[model samples]
Target: MRFLAHTECFFGKSRYDDLHSALGNTITGTGIALIDTAVVDSAAVRDLLSQVEIHFGNAIPVSAVSVLSEPTYDQLDDLAALVRQSDPSFILAIGGGSLLDLAKGVAVLLENPGLARDYRGMGLVKKELRTMICVPTTAGTGSEATWTASFIDDQTRIKLGINGPNVFPKYALLEPALLVGSPRKVALSAGLDSLVHAVEAVSSPLATPPATALAVKAVALITKHLPVALNSEEEDSWSGVQMGAYLAGLAMLNSPGGIASGVSYPVGTQFHVPHGFAGGIILPYVIDFNTTRGYRGYELLNPEMGSNRTFYQQIEELYGILNVPRNLSEWGATGEPAIRTLRELTLNQRSGSFNYNPIPFDEADLNSLLHLICQAD
Candidate 1:
């Protein structure tokens, strides 16, 4: 019954502009904006950021703006250094998950007085971080709603997550219009990622009733709307995808993810596959794997594709329609040796999700799943 996500969430086409008056004219100090370089460079996003600045007026000045590119753990340290010099009163994170995660790291470092590595796990930060507002330019990752921030440890090639209540953003603005310009590939990948989040959260053993409800609703929305949103110009489809992703994020924040995401992390990071694509590619296999152990979440999903088809079958078909990568080798995780390495890395970097899996799994189960996931189709 334990559920937590304290951020105030706003959803609409242009609701982001409301932040101007939401802060109540407190413009005495510096406001830092951590923006994705590619996103900020776009004409639309550039105009959006400018509007946000205009909304703030002079009460709080966005005195510093940093463009985040390919964020890594080292980047957090560098961002921290910059923040120390600027002394910003608040942080605005605008971009994908990496930028938002980096913003969390920067805010935590500003107040906690330590390196980003110090608070690598849950509940490590004793002090509250500076206020942060997250505006996600992409629909996946759910970084806007979650208390977890992930960073890569380049030395070990492991992506570590910083989890704590202090990491939660004070505000999350979900603007569907911002996602309209996403490349088709990005849209397909991110939409599937959101679907997987809903599935994993609903099926996790730790799921609370409220979280499960959100997960079910998210899954339904994603299943019905994602495919249409991928190639259509209709605003309703895109808006549905946006709201579904946010709900899926909230569900994961309360219940956490399970084996699918756990396996996807190492595979995606090690093989340079986009996280959403990696997760989507492995989703059907994980669903089949869980079915062996009496997992029933799929049964709870609406049986809309067809009465004869299983939920996994419907998703597998969707993967084909979306043209998701079919083989691990396509992403450079080829050969038995590479898969073995991925399996070991997955096991080594468990991310506390193994326990949340409804079925008991160990090295052998993981090995079998990896073989299936990597098999050429």
Candidate 2:
């Protein structure tokens, strides 16, 4: 059982203020703050920045950058160049997964030579990165707890991850207050993304007992809280989803993702589907496929549903409640041509999710799955 550890996490309702306090006490140098464009103007962000200003009292300057969209290699490189000019001692990333990923890429690029595309694969970063603190405003992607930073290839339009020990953040701040007013669709997609992470981690061939335990608990928490969190403003419900997402991320560090994760890349990059939605939409299908082939890994996720309903049915029912689409067709990734493109792209990308899937998934299996999901509904 191998486990890679990094990122000390602090969780609570308004613990985001702790980031400012930590920075004030420990660091005397300039820092860079990356804010998600969607939430940069929110009162929460404004208050945090104000607190930082008060704490520093002009002794240490912090530059704030607005980040939007899933970063492409070119975009990452451009951002890196801009951030390099500041030469910050640390980086504070506040936003969703995309913004956090952009911050991670920038942190690595500051210490490492070459373009973002150069470190597209695993363990390519040769140097230690600048200290990074991730504060996620969404409950998905688990970017805060993971060592992989995702980016898109500008030329190929393929989604790839820059993975290595250096990619791990120094700290993760999980403040549920940051998630209070997220859009309904955004919250739903993020919650479902965490759900997919837990499901895929438990279904991975490399899953350790510890990882399985974390993933199982994550599944239970997310399943119980996502609906309530989406429909209401209760901090406890949001907190549950947040903790579940973080645990799912930790689980994924030990146990790689499965077919659903592999398929999400192509679907997300090609169809412009949100990553979480892409994975969540395909998860139920993958679960059914695996169960029919006698794979019982998911049975541990929801034992209470029993043999009568099956774990797949439980997830499918949740999808109904969440309004998740049945297949890729809803995202316009339809037709045999699109499926062929996605299959080739998935193979070419060589996502580890394929290798780590609970069942043996070859080209034939991938092709079949693609067709099954891409069929018009």
Candidate 3:
């Protein structure tokens, strides 16, 4: 029954502007704004940033503030350097998972000695981070609500991260309007990432009763609303999906994802595939594999995902509707070399995830899973 989410969140169409009070009251002196360069000019973000400038100007001089945009993957050192140079009092991160993750890395490293590479495992981050306010423009990753942040190791090109209490943001503001302009691929991929989280959270051995409840609801919301939200321009649909993703994130925080993520992280890093797409394509195989082992919670989830079909059936159909890549080969992550890299990384870098899976797996079993996901057609 252990469940924890400390972020104070606000959700609505234009609720991003509500951060004015939080900014004015909490952020004094110089602060840094980490924005997604892709959306810096959008009307919604413009309005949000304008609000920040307006409110924060009254409390502190705005000239000292710094803005960094479009943070990239495998560049944790670069991001941390920027943060060190800025030396801001706080950070306001607005954008997708990458931007928010960069802010988290910076916040943690600013207090702790050494680079992002110094902290890799759970609970290594002991010192309190600078105040961070997360606002997610995309309805994916749920980075705003989670205490973990991931980055690729520049040298080894391995995906690495840290998870602990120190990195959680103090505030999360969700504005569904900001999600309206996401490219179709981005929208579908990100949405499916949340769906994977829901399924994995409930299926994981680490799942508790409270986390399972949240995961079930998240699965229901995603199944019912994601497709509708994709085609319809209604804010309500987007809002439902956004909240669903957030709940799924919370579920995952309590019970980290298992096999699908174990396979996807290495596949994504080695193959240069988007993390969400990698997880999206691999999740159906995981569902099929887990269900065969009498994994719990499908009975509870099937009803919510559409009572007419099994939970796995619903997920497969959702994949078709969303037009996601059906196999790893489509993304060029197949064959012996890709398989070997995936196996090594999964067994080493992502080994922590193995215990959380409902069923036990050895290297041979993992190889079979990779082959299953890498199949053509």
Candidate 4:
């Protein structure tokens, strides 16, 4: 329930200090803003900092800044060292999923090392973090807003995560302006991730009313805004995208997402596709698969689901709004060779995402689902 952003979110300007004040942390942080991004090296954070300096004077006092340069392996090593060394006040991450997730992993591992894998299934971290704040940039992943961190286990090559309320940031900074300038492609891929968040939340086995409500709001927002943002030469309407992304995060915080978002980590790690795109491609197929196979959680929202949309139309509309391919082949994946591996990975996933899928799937069921995604038109 506690997002790193101020629980009472502020719309304009840098509410960073206010968030800090509310959280009562003023100094050291493992901050990773887009400016610190290794993928593209964004200057947006620098510009935002400059403006802050202009308005509030010179000293930009932060605890520490951790740039996101490494993939999974090195990042965890670096994070572990930080906790072992300084014992800093907290970790504040400001980047995309990887960056935010890095912060979460660091915060949790520092405190709980004995039963690390025990925390793997869900709700296991059971401890408080060293303090943390998540400032999301791409408006997807919702890492800043969620309470769990997704990570890969290198040796097993199976996807896994460390979860608990402790992994959730002390605040989730929802700065719509911070998200405004990202390129359309990055925005869209991430937006699609959010759409998946909403859809899966609706049918997710983890369904709770609060989580379901958030997903619906997210779907409505994205359905209305993503296309406009995607096509405009200058997307002055970025706030809609930003809000949509936040709602998706909120939805997942509740329902956690089903198999598509669940299955994506394996695909991302094994196939080398980025997580957003990996998750995006599997979503529609999951919805299609679920339509005939399991209980649609949206039944709780029947009046709005209209028998057609929530059952069928709602899902069809999501794919259209995101403009994604209906199959994995469209995303360049081919054949049935990967199905077994996918099933292996799906079994590894166990709870967080796969458990919430509309239907309970065994190895054969998973293989079938992947085939549908691979072959669907």
For 125-199, candidate 1 gives per-residue lDDT tens digits of 888777888888888888898888888887886777888888888887776767886889778778878887999
Q: State the TM-score for model 3.
A: 0.91
- The TM-score values for the models, in the order shown, are 0.91, 0.92, 0.91, 0.78
Where does candidate 2 have its weakest 10-residue lDDT segment? Answer: 59-68
Worst 10 residues of 1 by lDDT: 61-70
- What TM-score quantifies how close candidate 1 is to the native fold? 0.91
Q: Which pairs of residues collide in candidate 2? A: none
Q: Regarding TM-score, does 2 or 3 come out ahead?
A: 2
Model number with the top lDDT: 2
Superposed model 2: Cα runs more than 4 Å off: 13-25, 51-68, 304-308
lDDT of 3 by residue, 1-377 (tens): 66798887876644546666555567677887777777766798766666666766643222211223222343667677867887888877888887788878888888888877778868999897788778787777889999888876666777667678988988888888788757777788788889889888998888899899999999888878889888988888888888999999999889989877777788877777777788888888877877777764577798776576777887878888877788878778777787787888888888777787788866787888888777767
Please give, for residues 238-277, the per-residue lDDT of candidate 2 as tens digits: 9999999999999988888888888888888888888888
lDDT of 4 by residue, 1-377 (tens): 42232223434454666654565424444332222343234555555555434433353434334543224534565656655566655554567677777777777766776534556657777677656656677778777767667766667656567765667666666655556666666777788888878878788765777777777777767767777767663444567777778878877777766777877776777666666777888776676666667655555544544454454566576567657666666445567666666666667654356567767765666777678766746
Q: Which ten residues in a row have the lowest lDDT in candidate 3?
A: 61-70
Clashes of each: 2, 0, 0, 11
C-alpha lDDT of residue 63 in model 1: 30
lDDT (Cα) of model 1: 0.78
